[model samples]
Target: MIAVPRAQLRRPLLSSVLHILSVLFVFDLVFAVTSRSLFSACASLALVGLVAAVSNAKYESLREPFVFTDLSLFSQLFSHPRLYLPFLSVGKVVAIGAGIVLVIAGFIVERPVLPGSRALVWLAAVLPFALAFPVAARLPLTLDPYVDQCRNGFFAVFVAYLLNGLRPATFRRFREVVAAGPFATGKPIRCPDVILIQSESFFDARRLGDEVAPELFRRFDDARREAVWHGEITVPAWGANTMRTEFAVLTGTESFSLGYARFYPYAFVRNKIASLASWFGRCGYDTVAIHPYYADFFGRDRVFPLLGFARFLDIRHFASASRAGPYVADASVAEAIVAELEAADDDRPRFVFAMTMENHGPLHLEQVLPGESSSRHTLGEHASWRDLTAYLRHIENADAMIGRLLDHLRTSDRETVVCFYGDHVPALPHVFEKLGVNPQHSDYFIWRNYGADAPERRNLAAEELGAALLRVVQDHGNRAEQPHASEKAT
Candidate 1:
């Protein structure tokens, strides 16, 4: 093989350096108006840009040569292509004009056109690229070169606004893209009496041995007598967005149906759902929803009604009753359920979907029960271990609450079926680190909770859980009919 020339090697390196410098300059000009210091702005851009470039380059190298034609991204984009028209109109015209001006200005401002003289020109180009890099990187690599170029065009316009230190109108457009979707709509199916309890951070911490709360394990054992107990449920988020899981269980659709790669119940789902409430409502049942948190906390005010609830009892309704940190206790929510059962005017059966909030997050043993040494006794000094213990204690509190509800249901004369599951796992980053648990494992607990007498539990998506629940209800209905038929034949 012929030896490579030094000039060729220098050419690519020089070009890359110039490209980087150009990106930096544009970034500086844009940031400087607000930052008030050119040097500081340029320095910040240089640092951030370099990191981003290296990351992008590494990511690009690992992938199969960035094929630019894949229907999936295009399909997603076109599914709500109307959302992008406004951005396209403004961005295309403004970005092209600004880019041309910056290129021309660079040639005029820098004298001699040599390495030193062209410094300002390089800065102008680099700064714009630095500012727009994130947007560019997020674009699918499988798009056509022209599509990538168009994305750059939008970035340029966005940068012009950034330089002027003005927020872009594109923010609203993004919200519209996320918001586009039909609300869940389907003919409802009549079902048996339904009770759904979303247990707070209910995962199996027994693997951590004595580090778990004693009351929690005791309550878990107690719950098994009357209800099916799934050992560990893998949840998506540790301490937040529990409603997303609830939404999935209520609606028989996955995150993909709402055009999200991840679970985001509040953002994607907007329509009335064929939930247990809706189904029971069609079946001549009185429907109500209970949550100890704010009525509006996950847009539940709008969503619960769509899910077929006739009424929702939230924190405002329970203002005088009981208190847990930042929310009404689970016990209070249980009372609300009992109250709804008693108050139903319709002769139809009642279906109540109650969410417990007493065991809400920052699940460190200390944050949950302050100044209480009994809560602290089970957990140890190790930060990694203590979190698991705290999570168990939280679960135990939820378990005890469930046990109380179950006991009440048992004593009551009305026939009721209570289905309880953890929404997601506790938000313990350290526990995840120790257990090597994948976030994807969040929906896996359905398998553990399925009893031997119960139907097989397959791995399911969050959105699919509602469908599974429907099937369970259907099975219960079928079994109920079988006995009735046998008695008639005898």
Candidate 2:
């Protein structure tokens, strides 16, 4: 048997422990700018690691406006890194690189944790401090919510991770909530066709309670006047996390009931539970979802099918579609909706969930004409920048798409109910900060091409929009034989 020096054994132990501390400090320093507190830093680092593990894309602090999101909501971030990596802050880039290096270094230098070792004893002793953190949270220096999390570095954040693991939401509870709510007792509509448009960043910027030129949202205002029932729906997200709003609209399930799963619904809600499409399917409708982007983006290719859509059409099928900026133009998406309707089997009603990507960001990438009329909607300072001008132009395109879709439906013989809404406000900090719109609110309107008096707009959450739509279509199904387009035009 070979004899090893005691000093050699102790040195390796020391190096391993020091290596762990050095790695954790990297995370602490990186998170200090955003978290500022021990618990938040621990949570943020853990989340970033999880995302890096699941998706190769780097987190963009400057472009993405979320820190507390779950893995499900981040699938879009996994898209070709070329689209997002350029906007990442330098500190975040270093931190992410360091985090990846540490992860690699961990495998190289790591030793198996022995149950009887001093490291285990130390871990056992310090873990009790998990309770002490909350108890000492009342004291200023010890908890240090006001100071940067780098103050405590490893111990406080480690303890925070331990404490957070104590409580987690279960799928069983999620099922109970879904079974009781969106799945409970709503009659399916008899309408021949129902089109729900989760238009990307399609809200009225003027609602920010800020000054804008009267004609800034000319096309949107025109649609509002023509709508039969329109309202202000409080969507699930703010600047980012399109999945949250989209999920809520399809399922009619609020994020509040989902706990941590709310941040990443796909991770938890995987089954074909009763959703808007499922409800319609039960009523003899062939459901189809159209999103003019990569199929796997935000896991929509998987989730939409599970949500009971019989068919899903993504970017691959739209090879001939025209582009406005980074994505297919919303006008082409509108034309696609008409094409889907025209191609649908005449035997059954159709439920079309059209999600447009024309107005999707980072708007900074777009090139816009200098001093265009849409320039008035920008923050006076950022008026010359690409982000503001690009968003204004993109949403203007989205407005035109809405008009095109309505025009086609208006002339068609079949009756259709169209529910249109913005997923969330664009993640434009300069514009939003100056304007002061409740970032959670987005505009929504329900329209039947046949025409009805536009109702007063009211506040709504995305989860409630589907039910509101159901009520609208179900309450007034089977209208009298309508006149031809030529007669109606007259």
Off by over 4 Å in 2: 1-78, 82-84, 95-169, 183-189, 208-216, 373-385, 435-438, 477-487
Please provide, for model 1 over 1-490, each residue's C-alpha lDDT reduced to its tens digit, 9 standing for 90 to 100.
0111111222223234433444555455443333333433444444343333322322222221111111122343355433222223344446445645654454445443123334564465465556454543333422222232233322222232232222232334323433332223333343345677787766555544554455555655655543422333344444445765776566544433432223344543445545657766776777788787667655678777877789888877888877655446777777787787667554577778888877665444244334343553454455556555555555656666766766666555454566677776555655656666534344222211111244344555555555555555545434443332123234
Report, for every candidate in turn, its global Cα lDDT versus the true structure.
Answer: 0.49, 0.64
Clashes by residue pair, model 2: 233-460, 234-460
Number of clashes found in candidate 1: 25
Per-residue CA lDDT of candidate 2, range 287-394, in tens? 998888888866777777777889999998789999997788999889989998898777787999988988877776667665664455534444444566677677
lDDT at residue 20 of model 1 (Cα atoms): 46
lDDT score of model 1?
Answer: 0.49
Name the lDDT value of residue 21 in candidate 1. 45
Structural RMSD, model 1: 13.2
